[model samples]
Target: MKQWLHLSAVAVFLTLLSVFPVLAQEEDEIDLSQIMKAAEKKSLSGGGFLEFQPSLIGLNRDSFFYQLNFGDQGPKRVGQYDFRVRLEGSYEKRTVGLYFTGDGLLRKGFQGWDSRARLFEGYLSLRLNPRFTLDAGKKTTKWGKGYAWNPVAFVDRPKDPEDLLEALEGFYVVSADITRSFQGPLKTLAFTPVLLPVLENLNSSFGKPGHLNFAGKVYFLLWNTDIDFLFLTGESRTTRFGFDFSRNLKSNLEIHAEWAWLTDLERIETSQDGRLSTTVSDEMSALVGLRYLTASETNFIAEYYHNGAGFGQRESEAIFEQAKSPSAVPGSRTGNSADAVFPPLLGIPNPMRDYLYFRTSQKEPFDILYFTPEFTSIFNLDDGSCQLIPGLTYSPQTNLLMRLRGIFLVGSEHTEFGEKQSNYRVEFRVRYFF
Candidate 1:
């Protein structure tokens, strides 16, 4: 039954793509003035996307994460299906606006069926004037200028490096934005301040309960360069200060950098003998990146990131060795304790001290309109581990998209990627907006 459902979905996707050109041609003939009028008259608007994705993964039986997760009863290969729907709506009245977005997801894999639903963002905004606006409820700050990583996004949730553009869940906060424009070398300036409160059953995932967090950002557009200074402090987490800048060196080349200082951050480490230890110290993290576009319309982005809070090479090796020990039993008391200490170091995105990211994409290759083929790589400099992803995306018609991608993990023993549960994965995604 599951196989049949998968085949049916593929057939439907192919049918839609095959007939999209005809539908698009008809849409292009619609009168633009009428569409504009419709938009102008609408104060309430809603739209969302429905997605279907199927994935195949090849497992690595010798990997540490695999043993920790499915020690004895795991499969060598796994096939999975996922479905997701996202809905966003907005209502505007003169100076006040309300916006909400939510998503639901369902997945079936080697384990079983799993499903979840949550509100990604829902906020109310009041614009006092052209220069100032206040917002309340749940929202995402989306700070920083880096394409893959944002070291200075202190108030926003961390982005997944594997799918950097995917929307992330937001936090509950009250915030405000104030802006100023000028004609001199400083073209624009803006300030944003945010307050986040954590309590039981609300934002418990963020940090410790019963704490109010404060964060802010000041931005300046000076000499055609974008600069920002940001800070976050509260009892829920350690205090941090960050700075970031971005500028274009040439018509086709741009550069960006971010630096952050964390005060008295805490970390936990496990030894080869399964003993856990904790350490606290001040740390600094930084990232530098560049984007270049060639004459052929191929775009390239590369970045080097240093994560001060991540595990060192020796620390990672010890953890991997512990997993490989014959007496190690996942879910046992010892394993549970080790697991608690591992995520802060090993479970985060780019969970290593030093890493490199590179991506390139060609737009509309071979005169194929609305199509792009891209390749991305994230390399861990500390352990020589890396992930390579090659993908193709196509927009057959307005608000309709399709993507196919493959992920390959490469690493040696005791390396970051080498100990992952899967060595390779292939996935296909289709989404339709309405």
Candidate 2:
């Protein structure tokens, strides 16, 4: 933390030096009285966002949320969902930056802190020519490009409390990314090879393992189709590799897949005889999605993600039956006993998990790992809101933005809610963007 402070101090000082050329100006024009005012107006800026949110739980449990957004230029909106703001500047090979983005819900936590601030991302990136991009900040991991890829929900609104808590923490990510990029009119492709160095404050386990990784990707546009491919190799000692591909199908539908192969991967393998061996198993996965526009007034999408090792999950709220009989609720006996307590009066917990949760190579760019089960809503199709997202956006009077959506995921008779095999959600939002 102290190091970052020093770095920020040095950056601020250099910013003044670089932005203001006292040397280039006439000596007589250097007025001490106006120095501070000049920097204040030209080099300083600030902005913030505001929002309101309320939810009615279908399982009809404890469902209530109020959120706000206050930041300098934030995240990009997904149609009308989210936004991000990032500040970037460079001096020679060095750079100074601060960027943050959040969802529509802005809930405060203990001591008036923003709930998203705990893991909201902030980082400094340094590029040494075309060979490497070194970064250190509150970095989100580069996991499989599934729904669960992001850890910071400050700008990404999640529906469930369980999903909110599983979000990743802000860690000091120090990574060296070496890349070759190509951007053109006809088609473009770039391949990046990354290596993560040591990170002092990583959001990992007490005995978190370090990692080595090798990954590259390509992109092409043939005909009217857009194609993207990503491949990665990772390890603590042994190694694992992942591959992903996405392509537009027919015009209204899309398809994408993710796969991971473990190579004798081992964190720590110890036997009763004290002999040690490290082994990593291989895994495969595929995600298929289709979206159709029916008469423009009604549109729907269907997405399915399957893991060979049964380790894929979608983010959604976990409802606790208000217990008509009190004792029927099983209160604290539930999993993650501490989670039973109610949320802070003003702050909210999302309770959503990864769309395909897996964040590896903590604290560094080389931190590569496999996916984990979030046990969220995507697990169900007919009953859960994840597998199917059907909604419509309308302009009631051209000045108003209105949208209505229904999400359904079918739960298993033996999983999620055990005997409860159904859950559903309906969301309606109106926005006046001026």
Candidate 3:
């Protein structure tokens, strides 16, 4: 039954692709404005992208992560191939709308071939009036103002620093949006409330099972500034409250910040002697950033983040020591659990106290149309480690894009970036949009 359903979905997707060009041609021959107006009331649109990436990675065999992952003996270099497909569509009929995004990936790596498929987002929305809307199903409520990091995104997954703008997989949720407009200093006001349930087979990765989480966000646009206050509370996780704001200082300069405070957050740490300890305390996380566009079309972004819940330098070094210990066992009581050590270090990127992010991108440099060059740096203030990335992007055609990039990790021993499994990597990617 599942196989038949999958095949039927593929057939429908192909039919939509085949129909789009015909509809485009017909619209070009008619009154486009009138057609557009009518189509807005009842429309179905679908599009997505295909991408291929090849990467060469240089291993850091002496690092703790390398030993934990590959054991004593590991390769010096690895070649990997990655292929991805995204299929997204939306259907709207008056006040009712349906939207979905599906992703599929195939990877050829040192471990051999692997493939996976996922529905990143599939949601149904209802607009009762111009000012109120409701949504149910899997959705991403991107509520933070930070670009590289969003400490205040209480209901959303953490963003990947390397791919900050990438679409994230969302959790099952029931949510609503209410908006109001004013004529005075406060021009706009909006509120969003979300209810998320975690069950044995649904949204299990979110937190503890059998709990319903409640979260909400209130927005205010006042005096040309955008501000938001948000909170989350439930049995699944600690209660937290946060706020974010964004403002344009000038035509070419903008600034944003996010702050979150978590009450009684639980943290686990490992001692150098391989003893595990847990702590519960109040914690705060914050990020402040700015974006500046120069006259030469060079865009610069800088951010500073302080993660009060993260491990300090000494704590991180102890964890590294535990991972490197030859006698470390998963189930041992005296020694730290191998399971606990690896997940905190590898699963969470930049699990340190302080960080600095800087990125600069030049658009169409030297009059080379559709070509851009960029550089990014993420520095760990606590451990004095950093990752540097330089890349170039070019769009040779309207539907195609090419990107080439190199990533290098720099740090001394016992530092965050220095102990990464990979010392450096180079990758080339090609993507096509439908």
Candidate 4:
């Protein structure tokens, strides 16, 4: 099956290559003036992508997550296929505009075929002036300075560390943006404020229902530095204050940082003997990162993250021990037991107290246009566990992309990465836009 998938991908690549010349030839015969006139008159536009991804996973049946999720019927290895379709459209009339984006996925895994559909983003906006705008409906406010992790993204959903660039589902909200341009050291200033309401069956996943939440961000471009001050308050979640900054130290080097403080943040811990406990206190999380580009077009990124809400090494070890034990019950465990406590602790991207992330990518090596190879690693500073990912991406033609990647988890028993279901995974993805 894996060989077939590889051959199929190769066939598609060749087909696209053959069609590219013909498409280019046809493009040269088009009238540029007519195209421009049509573009000026067209107010509605739509585009999206269809993606196919096949993966092979080497499972660790003895891992804590594997044991809890698959129980006694777990498989040692698995092959999975995924198909995804994303559609996005926008319509503009004068100062008013409407935008929507939706996606659907079909997957065949060890369990069987499964499907899901969701609206990722949908919003209406009114431009009051050149520097002011208002929007309402479901939207994503991607705020933060960190690349892999966003410690100060108080108003947005948590990012997937493995795929930090993937689009995420948005929350319902009303928001406004006001901007002002300056003439001196301060180049620009912007203010964004949002009101998010959580009611029955609407934005219920964000926090406690039946409450209104308020969040805002103040941005400034001063002395060649990008800075932001953020805040969130209300009944749905804990009130939080955040600050983030980004600046370029040189033409090829940049630095960024984020810090957030949450009031009355909750922390949960499990004991080695299967006992659980919870505490509430103010928490602080911070991240510092840098990006650099070398003369040879090689890009590098490194980050250090401190997760105040994450578990301690001892707590994580206790949870894993309980999960590996045969006497642990699956369904009857409560908040005070390790069986029920491991899910939330292990499900997060980085559930440990401290982490270090590094990534390097070489662009268009050997003069191969639109081709890149990258390597990334996330090290758990607390438990000495780590994940290594290496990938190659190629774009043979416009609006088409292909990527092949591998993931390897390394750790000892009772460590974070060692408790994952899959020790390694290999995947290939082909995506085409229309």
- Cα TM-score per model: 0.89, 0.47, 0.88, 0.89
- Backbone collision count in every prediction? 0, 49, 0, 0
What is the TM-score of candidate 4? 0.89
Clashing pairs in 4: none
lDDT of 1 by residue, 1-434 (tens): 99999999999888886877556467566677987986685679999999999999999887777777777677899999999999999999999999999999999989899999989999999998989999999999998888888878888888988899998899999999999999999999999999999898777888889999999999999999999999999988789999999999999999999999999988656666656577899999899999999999999999999988887787778776665665567634446533554556556677778999999999999999999999999999999999999999999999999999999999988998998889999999999999
Ten contiguous residues minimizing lDDT sum, candidate 1: 331-340
Instruction: Give residue 161's lDDT in candidate 3 (0 to 100).
Output: 87
Order of quality (TM-score): 1, 4, 3, 2
Identify the runs in model 1 with alpha carbons over 4 angstroms from their true place. 1-32, 268-276, 331-337
lDDT of 3 by residue, 1-434 (tens): 99999999999878886877666466556666987885664388999999999999999987766765776667999999999999999999989999999999999999899999999999999999979999999999988898888888888888888888789999999999999999999999999999999999998988889999999999999999999999999988889999999999999999999999999987766666656577899999999999999999999999999988898887777776666566674224345544455575545888888999999999999899999999999999998999999999999999999999999999878888998889999999999999
For the record, the alpha-carbon RMSD of candidate 2 to the native fold, in angstroms, is: 19.3
Q: Which stretches of candidate 4 lie over 4 Å from their true place?
A: 1-31, 34-41, 269-275, 330-339
Question: Where in model 2 is the C-alpha error above 4 Å?
Answer: 1-48, 58-98, 101-116, 127-134, 141-171, 175-187, 196-201, 205-238, 249-254, 263-280, 290-300, 311-329, 333-413, 417-434
Worst 10 residues of 2 by lDDT: 62-71
> What is the total number of backbone clashes in candidate 3?
0
Evaluate residue 45 in candidate 3 and report its C-alpha lDDT on the 0 to 100 scale.
Answer: 91
Task: Write model 2 residue lDDT over 261-356, tens digit each, in one string.
Answer: 534422223344543333355544455554444433223434455433221121112222222124333333352321243222113321222233
